[model samples]
Target: MKKYISLFLLSSILVITSCDERFEELNTDPNRPGGSVFDPNLLLPTATFQHGDLITGYSGPILFQSMWIQALASTSTGGANYYSNADKYVASPSTPNYIEGNWNVGFSLSSRLNQMQILAQQRGLNNLNAVGQIMKVSALSVVADTYGDIPYSEALQAQQGISQPKYDSQADVYNKMLSDLEAALNSLSASGDQLRNDVMYRGDITKWRKFGYSLMLKLGLRLTKVNASGAQSWVQKAVAGGVFTSADDDALVPSDEANGYSNSSANALNVPDDIYEVRWSKLMIDYLKNTNDPRLRIVAEVPPAGLAANRNGLVVGNNDPAVQIGLPNGFDLRGGSFDISNHPNFPGATGSGGDVAIIGAYSRPTAIYRRRNAPVFLLTYAEVQLLLADAAVRGFVPGSAADFYRQGVLGAFTSMAKFGGETVSASAATAYINANPLNVSSANASLKMINEQIWATTSLFANFLEAWNNWKRTGFPELTPVNFPGNFSSGQIPRRQPYPAGESSTNGESLRAAVTRMGGDNWITRTWWDGGN
Candidate 1:
């Protein structure tokens, strides 16, 4: 009994001695620096790369927007068809998956950016904070554009105990984005240590400023229909702040061959069998061919053995500018008269030797675009130039709209060559611009011509969402609506995607209110900036 009591006393003493007040300090992980506080540099690349991927990735642009804009078409039938309903203006269950994916990506990336901003402010890392702010706005802008109202002010505030954030109006979101961009620009400086992981611009503070201002230009133009005075003010402000002046200042994210990090369009269009299913749409091909645009050869290619024998080392039909054929939208294999043998350029002998009218015979994306490492263009100088041309037409900026228009066309051609792995000579670009000068006789005609050129230029980058947005704003290109039976929106093209269905359960009240405010969460509901055109 005495021995047991002595042992118990010794154990109690040991426990008491081990109980230090700084227990957490003693156990602190040496591996983790500044626990729970991440370096802003580390977070910058993640936010930029993920934001770029989300915007240019499969779910956001390639799958829906590209098809809607008639840049690409679905050739598969039944279960294998991914964009059948989307191409035909019919709703499908998979759409919400895409919506949710985009929503999650935007918010998830912004959450990290929010953390980085807070940490940077604490550390007096002003430039890093500015980068984070710009990225946050960029990520959220996609969300707001995609779904009208979204949680903005109250978003990324879970640590403050606000679990369910309220959705801000689209107008409010845009206003906030513009204000945030301006704040970021003001905070940025070349004096400080730049972000080490700045993947887009590689720590070039001037380019970052230009990127922010370019975003301002885009957002400002977005308000043209709804707020002309506001648009003019912001456009002028952006130009004064120094927008992208050349292709060298284009904001592009270099992609690797990895699955998630690879180019989104290439991922969708470069597969062995899947590549055959996707081809240039009739809208894009016909427009390029009719206009005698030099970009057509760079953007598209004929299938193997689809044309006559090789001539002068050229791949015959594949390389010949005249032999390209685009498959019509809203058609399956049987629906489209895809019999290559019946094609006028078919070089097969009589009926016995012709190539089958299948996926291989149609014009597909160019080889350069299918490469694994093709860079993803986030925003380009050409787009800014085109916007400037529009602003000039509105008399919002001082410049010849025709000259800006020509510059925009040239910029687009130059930028596209980087992706197509083709060399478009300056002379060729100049010749094309000379041939297709902007018609400036009437304001209406000039605006229409500029917007039409915007459409064509945007298609080269597969910038479908922006193209659709511009089409909605200016009503140019006059795309024929798909009239498939049982189609949603009465055979009209979708104006917006429906909110993710999961939002109904997780954020029901907020989601319901947003839907009510937007006048219903269907595809045809015009967003705040849409102006109901």
Candidate 2:
């Protein structure tokens, strides 16, 4: 027994010694530099990806409504229209709290753009990387416009070791943006393996070149009222270099079942009754109804109540919910269209459909619909031709604006199918052309015709950002500030969105400096162009 106890005690002692060593090993000495996954490139793509998402939503459908609804062309079938607020006189966060959420989302995107630019420059020139630079400018523009002032000259240098960036003046930023876009346009000529990452163009340098040129045109046009000389020169350059000749060439972000960006924007706009609630505004409906445009049929369907057998002919204004068609633009009192139906009361799930709408809401608590494939439309042939026609009409270019206008119409018409939108065939194009011939051409028509066409295209196309940008540039179709109605007691349409609140609080000093130089950052604080005075 004594011998056995001795052996057992010794074995236990050895076992305890082993346990001590193992424990010491696991308690890792905090001495060595452990594996830190802090690669900039790793975070870069994620930022870039978010860039398209956040910017597209804020600028596209969200702000686009400000223009369309204010123009009285479209409305909130569900109060989803910005101009509906104008019509009803409601102060919205989209307006007042424009800069509230996700400034980081954009800065995150900007950071990525910054990194890509450096990577491309460091690695030498390639079309793919050059496109990255172009996207960088695009992303930054959204930041500047939204916030009034942005970190341009010194921004996005974290990869290069920039911690806190100073703000760049709005004017100077615009200038730099134009310069960057111009370079991006030139960079489109990069050959060979460089074109591989040109996802938008599929290794097509010519298309990238055109995309860059078109962006230049867009930038130039933005300065139309601010710097006619600058705007005119760039527009001429765009025409000379060639621009997006078709919608197929647009830099659209495609959506799908798994990833839909617009869904976020749409959710930020949900109305009561679980519906999207936006539809044709009075101005749009009037014009369409007056012209008897066929497209109206494709874009809008009568409300469920309006489509019911008993309410077959019920006009939109009728109160019988079952027979109510979508309200016209500026009509809100009677609930309008139903986006989709959801039966929340099925089983254990809480009662469905009493969703509280929150503006600038990022979580998009209500957006569960499958994400759709929507390519980001960088530019389009119709837009290029329109710029040419505008320049020609103004006598800024050599060619006849009339011819360009006709081409633009045809080109714009062809873009429909490429965007995953409704398309009319060559036959229809010919018929439309023959019926409305170049005996006048598309461009030389009355400003009303030319402008209306642009507006009509804007209304039908899914490229809401393009629509908003175009409106900002040309102010065509005279979508007089919806503030014109009681909504305009202050009498102004928001020219740009405010800086995201996070940036202001975290990066306050620089943001303040930007605001001071840019005129209090008020809705009335016009940027460079806006008719130049």
The candidate maximizing TM-score is 1
Candidate 1 residue lDDT tens string, 71-125 = 7765544345656555676555565566677787788778768766766886789
Q: Candidate 2 overall Cα lDDT vs. reference?
A: 0.51
Show pairs that collide, candidate 1. none
lDDT of each: 0.73, 0.51
Candidate 2 C-alpha lDDT tens digits along 1-533: 11111222233333322231232332244542111311222223233345556644443344444344333222232134443443344444454443443355556556555544444454554554666677777767765655557788987655356656889877788899888787767656644444432334546677767777777777776776777788788888877787776666666544332422233443333433223234344455455455444344444433322112112222222222122123333333233221112212111111224432211010111112112344444456776676666766666678775677678777767765554434566876766655654334443354446556666665455445455555666665666554323452366555554565566676788878877877766545666554354
Give the lDDT of residue 37 in candidate 2.
16
TM-score of each model, in listed order:
0.87, 0.71
